[model samples]
Target: MSAKTNEPFTEEQWLKFVQQKQLKFVECQDCHKMSVIPFAVCTTCGSRNITWKQASGQGSIYTYTITAVPPPELQAIAPYVAGVVELQEGLRINGIITGVENVNSYPADLVGKTVSIEFLELDRKSILAFRLNA
Candidate 1:
């Protein structure tokens, strides 16, 4: 099967980005800032000398919102928390936080706490997720 998004990249590339469970980021040779969602050139310094590095998979919740209305496929998973996480490597990514049974009952103090990656399987595709560290 293919990814639901129909991205142009081959399955091998997509699988590498998924099953490998390694968070890949681009480090700008000019600016030295790392970026997620790998690119051909550094978006910050416009340098093509970017290199890939595996992330530590550790991060903190920078901001988030409770998603009440999602796509039909996601409706069954309503009231899920969607948040932007600031990775230890300094890149931010939007992802769903799992393992927290109740979003409302969960303490607001959960923010800024450490989290780690948790790969999720959906519709034959693997997705990257996160959960608060114990």
Candidate 2:
């Protein structure tokens, strides 16, 4: 997998959002439904006319997994957690889980737990990540 927004997330446009320090999501122009994952059409209205909106970046860990075998690009930061965060806007997006050096430091379980945004800066590029919320 790549840090650059995956398929359907449209790299150029998605990166623009990330660079702007905004968590962007698609909102159906017709139905006004939000979708964090990029798609060919709105899941609700099946409309192609959708616009990007800035999300509040507050969410909960829908689910998570710690990667013991880090990818080559992130070997230095091995054993990281990655998961889908369900934002306050009612959409879920994938992001790396941060602010933990290991798996056993949680005060509570991650699933359904609250989280906040923490942009990870790597090699002059900014990427979306998360940390446990207070």
Candidate 3:
């Protein structure tokens, strides 16, 4: 008997996409506008000539807030920092800021501070995060 093989290509592709730290953005060949999320066709000019490009992985802290009350599963890790970081390439994503011991000590003037990408493990999955670029 032959063994049956099944694998979700899209999911696997997405996993690899995230694991490799490859930031893909859709660039319209016609309008020359880049979008963070990939699309089959460009939303700006309705062009299908969009291509994916890698980002520099550098950004700034747009905004952030601290969460003290986490869900039951995350209760042990309460008092975490979450924020939306605006990438230098013009993409904004929400992620946790690691490497900080005290939330109160977090600098409020982080809006223009440089940051870089970092990954963390949660529930057996890798999550994209950011860290101060000291």
TM-score of each: 0.75, 0.77, 0.76
Per-residue CA lDDT of model 2 for 5-79, tens digit only, reads: 343445466678787677887777788877666555777778877666788889999999878787888786667
lDDT for every model?
Answer: 0.71, 0.76, 0.67
Pairs in clash, predicted candidate 1: none
Clashing pairs in 2: none
Q: Kindly indicate the candidate among 1 and 2 with the higher TM-score.
A: 2
Model 3: lDDT equals: 0.67
**The CA-based lDDT of model 1 is what?**
0.71
- Candidate 1 residue 46 Cα shift, in angstroms, is 4.3
Q: After superposition, how far is residue 52 of candidate 2 from its true place, in Å?
A: 1.6
Best by TM-score: 2
Highest-lDDT candidate: 2
Tens digits of per-residue lDDT for model 1 on 1-111? Answer: 123433323335544777666567666767896766565566677776656667788899888777777877667667787788899878898888776657767556567
The regions of model 1 sitting more than 4 angstroms off are 1-16, 44-46, 104-106
Rank the candidate models, highest lDDT first: 2, 1, 3
Q: List clashing residue pairs in candidate 3.
A: none
Q: Count the backbone clashes (under 3 Å) in each candidate.
A: 0, 0, 0
| lDDT tens per residue, model 3, 2-119 | 1332312233544566676555455667788876655656667777665555667788889877788777755655687777889887888787776555676654555666778887
| Candidate 1 Cα deviation (angstroms), residue 110 | 3.0
Judge candidate 2 against the unseen true structure and give its global Cα lDDT, from 0 to 1. 0.76
